[model samples]
Target: MATLEIRDLHVSIDTDQGAKEILRGVDLTINEGEIHAIMGPNGSGKSTLAYTIAGHPRYTVDSGSITLDGEDVLAMSVDERAKAGLFLAMQYPVEIPGVTVSNFLRTAKTALDGEAPPLRAWVKDLKSSMEALRMDRGFAERNVNEGFSGGEKKRHEIVQLELLKPKFAVLDETDSGLDVDALKIVSEGVNRVKESTGLGVLLITHYTRILRYIKPDFVHVFVEGRIAEQGGAELADRLENEGYDRFVTSTPVA
Candidate 1:
């Protein structure tokens, strides 16, 4: 099975004042076919972890390593990460003004796979996944995330998740700004992809609402740039009841 490993990972970014450390030393291991939820309050470095794993140049890795099945992930380029079966669904999906949804998805698939998919089969899969997410057929012709409602943008991300068929996916704040119905629909789309592809997920969020729909195999509490607590699905229930006060007050690891 594929494994994504992070050991003693320290990350920082250059701000106006100076370089600010974000991830102190985070160690995590995710295997195929598991959903690991990383939950914490805002600015706890949850989103930083997601972007760092995706190799965004903004976050500098001060030390440690991120490996995919013993391969040096940090050595690979951003596109190489995706080609190696890693996908990141951003908190704020960006708009590609001139690129239509169908073209973007197809181009991405072609880039990842080294060749275009059979056109007929690609169209069929695209239509099916979009329908499962309850996206209108008209969306296929619309520009990528251009003027889409927040919920629609999120659903579109999941559509890419299903079509890309990555071995691992980092979803940052996917549940934010979604209403009751939209939340459930997005959650269903994620669950469907997991069931079909055994996709390992690192789902980052602040609340337990998304957990209700997409059950996590493991729940991790991020505080001060490190995992403060971890447990099974029950941990999420406790967090929903108790919040992060206990974890927040603890001393951070150096």
Candidate 2:
């Protein structure tokens, strides 16, 4: 079984005001087939943790260790990290204006596997995954995320996740801006991928609504760049009712 481990991670960003630390000694572990939900208020460094794991150039890991199994993830390049089975579904997926969805998926798959997937099998898998995500077949010819709705973009991200079959995925606020129906559909897509591939998930969200559909084995409360508390799925219920008021002094954006 594969495992991702983050130990005392400290990350910073270069702002106009110089380097400002975002993650302060964060630590966590995710084993294969485990779903870990990280719920927190705004500016709690939840997204920072996700970006750090995905090897985003904006975030600087000053002192820490990120490892997949025994391999050092911190030392790997961004594409190298993806090849090592670490995937990040960004909060705002960028629009690739010139790249069609089919081309982008195939290119990414080829890069990760070090070989081109046979055209017939690749097309079959792509069509099947898009159908499961309720994506229109026409999307295959459309430029990636070009003029797509928020839900559509999120669904496309899941399509990548399903097709790529990553060992671990860091979903950053995937539930954001999704309507009730869209949320259910997207959540089901994630659950289906996990069931089929035993994919480990580190889901970051501000509400418990998504948790109801994608039940996490562990719930972590992130406060001020650190994990303030941790518990089982029941912890999400408490957050739904009580919120993070007791954890922090100010009212956090839910």
Candidate 3:
């Protein structure tokens, strides 16, 4: 089984004053077919971990290492990380103006696989995934994320998840801004991928609602830029009831 491991990870970002540390010595190991839910308050560096794993240039890894199946992940470029089977669904997905959704996905899949997918198979999979997400057929022709509502953007991300079939997916606050119906739909899409591909999920969210559907195998409580506590699904229920007062201290940064 493939494994993604991070040890003694220390990340810092530049601000007006100086470089501010976000992740302080985080150690996590996720194996194939395991769903790990990372829950914490805003500014706890939850999203920072996601971005860092995706090789986002804004966050600097000051020390420690990240490895995928013993391969040095930090040395790989951003796109290289994706081709190596790491996928990130951002909290705020960016718009790619002038690029149609169909073209962008096909291009991304082609880049990752080193060859374009067969035209017939690609179109069939695209249509099927979109229907499963309740997205309109016309969305395939629309510019990627152009004029899309928050919910629509999220659904589009899941469609990519199902089609691309990455080994591991870092979903950063995918439940945010989604209504109850949309949330269930999106959650089902994720669950479907897990069932089909045994995808490892690093799901980052502040709310417990999504947890009801995703059903993580491990619940990690992130506080002050590190994982302060961890447990099973019961831990998530405790969080919903008692909140993060026991874990939070000092100031927080985004």
Candidate 4:
């Protein structure tokens, strides 16, 4: 069991005007077996929060700390953080033309566990997970996300999550660009993985459609690089009804 803590996190991007801060003193905490949904408008720094937690190189941590299970994550490299039980499913999953999904998963699993699984068992688990996601067995042989549909790409990320079994995972817009059926499949996959792994989830999304399927323990409204409001699942419904204009107008974008 692990807890992910982000305290007073301030992120900045390099620009002509020097470092311009994006995340302003953001504070969030997620413990094992909890799902935290962060919703916000465009350019509100929701993605920045996700990337910072994942230790993306472009996002400069002006001030703050990201701690997972008592270790300072900001000091670790991206690969180190992944080894330390943190996973980030990017909003735009890249396409690696030469890398097969099977090979990629094998490398990641071996790196995390310090040993590779038996060939038979690894193939069985991968096949079963792909079947659960409604994906074809051929997907394992295909290059990662190369020529895949939007839904397929998103499902691929879920496949990675199910296989990796990281202690803490940040899903950035996993629900975006997915249709109704794809959304349900992905949501179900997420739920299944969480149920089995007891992983803490920080889900970054712009709409409530996904929330209808996976009930979040907490829903937070992020505006102007900070969390403006947070509450139970009902808060998601409230935002759906009222929209985000009031909250967006209140917070200056900077």
Candidate 5:
């Protein structure tokens, strides 16, 4: 089974004033078919952890190690990481003005698999996946996220997740800006992918609404760049009612 391991990870970023530490010392392990939900208040370094794992240049790893199935993830470049079965769905999906959605997805699939999929099979799969996500057929012809709505962009991200079938996915605030109906549809898509592929997930969010559909196996409360508490799905229920007030007050200012 595939496993992503993070050990005492410390990350920092350069700023106008000075260097600022983000992830203090995060240690977690996600195996295939497991879902880990990370819930925290704003500015608690949640997105920093996601970006660091994805090998973002802006976030510097100060210490510790990240390994994927015994391979050193920290040593791999961003694309190399993706090729190794790591995927990150960004909070704000970027627009590729000239590339059509179909072309971009196929190119990515070809790169990851090291062989171009058969044209007929690829087209059929693309059409089916889009229809399942309730995306119109014309979306395949349009430029990637060029004129798409927020919900459309999010659904497109799920389309990539389903088609790419990565070993692990780090979703950074995917539920943000989505309405109730859109949220359920996106969450259902994620669930379907996980069930089919045994895909591991590290879901980051502030509210518990998405949890109603995704149903995390483990719930981790992130406070001031560190995980303060962890438990089973029941933890999410407590968080939904209690919020992160207790954790916020306990964390020291930087």
Candidate 6:
């Protein structure tokens, strides 16, 4: 039931001299059940766009607005944004030294649902979801992402997605550092979530490997902090074959 609307979103980071702009006027709208893939070069501000939408505190919004279900999201705090149904799977999963996966998941579930699910039911659901993602049972007992492998961390994020069932999710480079098998498993988990929950996805990545398993509804080429071109899933294929040089070099700077 959430509609994500971004209009001319411009973001900058504070520096000693002044602010250095990253995202330059990005405009996008994602409906409840659509998958939109954003592919860009290294400094194209792909992650910046994702973090900005999820209400990260580091980046400052210089202009434009982000709305969720007709409510102004930029006005909401990070906690309020999550409570309002926006989720972000970070590229670099954070390490929580004292928080076990089960505990963190339970806390998130409680926060989102406004009540704690019984321990028995929570464990049952957790085990089932972990199995579905081909994760080990030991994962639940370990501190969240403290010493997890690249694949394990990524899978854990997917587990959070399954448990949270967020309306809108921004997957920021989830494919990074994943092996071939890991990539397939991650993509499968993402596809399962989209199919079962009707969740809207804004997948941001630099590579096309992940797109093979989870075909995007739309693909946008991001260059120099702005979207240069957009097309169907075939655009991903084209980029894979031709590379982003042509797109990036030809794109005008903001």
- On lDDT, the candidate that comes out on top is 3
- Each model's TM-score, in the order given? 0.97, 0.97, 0.99, 0.97, 0.97, 0.96
For candidate 1, the TM-score is 0.97
lDDT against the true structure, per candidate, is 0.94, 0.94, 0.96, 0.92, 0.94, 0.91
Off by over 4 Å in 4: 249-254
Error of 4 at 219 (Å): 0.6
- Candidate 3 is scored at a TM of 0.99
Candidate 3 residue pairs in clash (backbone atoms < 3 Å): none
Q: Write the per-residue lDDT of candidate 2 for residues 1-254, one digit (tens) a residue.
A: 99999999998899897898888889899999999999988888899899999988998899989999999999999999999999999999999999999999999999999999999999999999899889999999999999999999999999999999999999999999999999999999999999999999999999999998999999999988889999999999999899888898543321
> Which has the higher lDDT value, candidate number 1 or candidate number 4?
1
Reference-based lDDT, residue 10, model 3: 97
Candidate 1, superposed: residue stretches over 4 Å from native: 250-254
What is candidate 1's CA lDDT for residue 165?
A: 98
Best by TM-score: 3
Query: How much does candidate 5 score in TM-score?
Result: 0.97
Worst 10 residues of 6 by lDDT: 245-254
- In every candidate, how many clashes are there? 0, 0, 0, 0, 0, 0
Where does model 3 exceed 4 Å of error? none
Task: Name the TM-score of candidate 6.
Answer: 0.96
lDDT of 5 by residue, 1-254 (tens): 99999999999999898988888899999999999999988888899999999999999999999999999999999999999999999999999999999999999999999999999999999999998889999999999999999999999999999999999999999999999999998999999999999999999998999999999999999989899999998999998899888888644323
Angstrom error of the Cα, residue 103, model 1: value is: 0.3
| TM-score (C-alpha) between model 4 and the true structure | 0.97
